[model samples]
Target: MKHREYGVVQRVDHHGRTAIVNWYRTYTSTDEPVPQLLYESEMSVYDLKDHPDFQYRPGTVVIRVANFTGEDANCTAGQ
Candidate 1:
């Protein structure tokens, strides 16, 4: 599986166990369009303090999306 690191947590849906994340627009690549939101079930969120990037705020968190190749990313969360 491949991993794609997303940006700061804009908002979280506690009921759905999901989150809305936003990427740093300045740093995005041209090869592919990065989604502005990702699900927590398909990703792992970590405090921005642990990230090496200086763009994000300290109190915010970043998400690393779980990419399962041809399969669904959300399928590997709890199982």
Candidate 2:
């Protein structure tokens, strides 16, 4: 039940408290194809601005990829 993060940015939705980012899974250990649609939840635009994993550049798209296992499922389950 682990959620693995990945690369690729396609769209950004900021209607709710968290920013909904649409991205693709370009890499995976499984035999599935790459560039698949991946889900990102509970991400805020403000948080992305100060995230250490990625830098928010001017006019540049910022994405935060996180992996949440069953133990960490609470962090990204309802969004």
Candidate 3:
């Protein structure tokens, strides 16, 4: 499923050409009466424009709000 989410670039590794992205999610659950948000961080090798969640030009520090797959938003490191 697709959901609206946001990702912020937290750190970049020039040598590895990778960036650490902090992702945020806001959603309303059937069991909950109010909206809730979640936060997660991940590393990616794709450029900002090529990233699945970050397809726009990013500044030194960046934040992009876009539609993301449920798998992408719920993914956690180390399974």
Ten-residue stretch with the least lDDT total in model 1: 40-49
Against the true structure, candidate 2 reaches a TM-score of 0.29
Candidate 1 lDDT score relative to the true structure: 0.49
| Candidate 3 backbone collisions, by pair | none
Ranking by lDDT: 3, 2, 1
Q: Against the true structure, whose lDDT is highest?
A: 3
RMSD of each: 14.6, 14.3, 12.9
TM-scores for the candidates: 0.29, 0.29, 0.39
Model 3 CA deviation exceeding 4 Å by range: 27-37, 50-79
- Give per-residue CA lDDT, model 2, range 1-79, as digits (tens): 1234443333456576455565454556545434567565556656644324545555986443454445553575345
Rank by TM-score, descending? 3, 1, 2
Cα lDDT listed for each candidate: 0.49, 0.50, 0.56
Question: Residue 65 error for model 2, in Å?
Answer: 24
Clashing pairs in 2: none
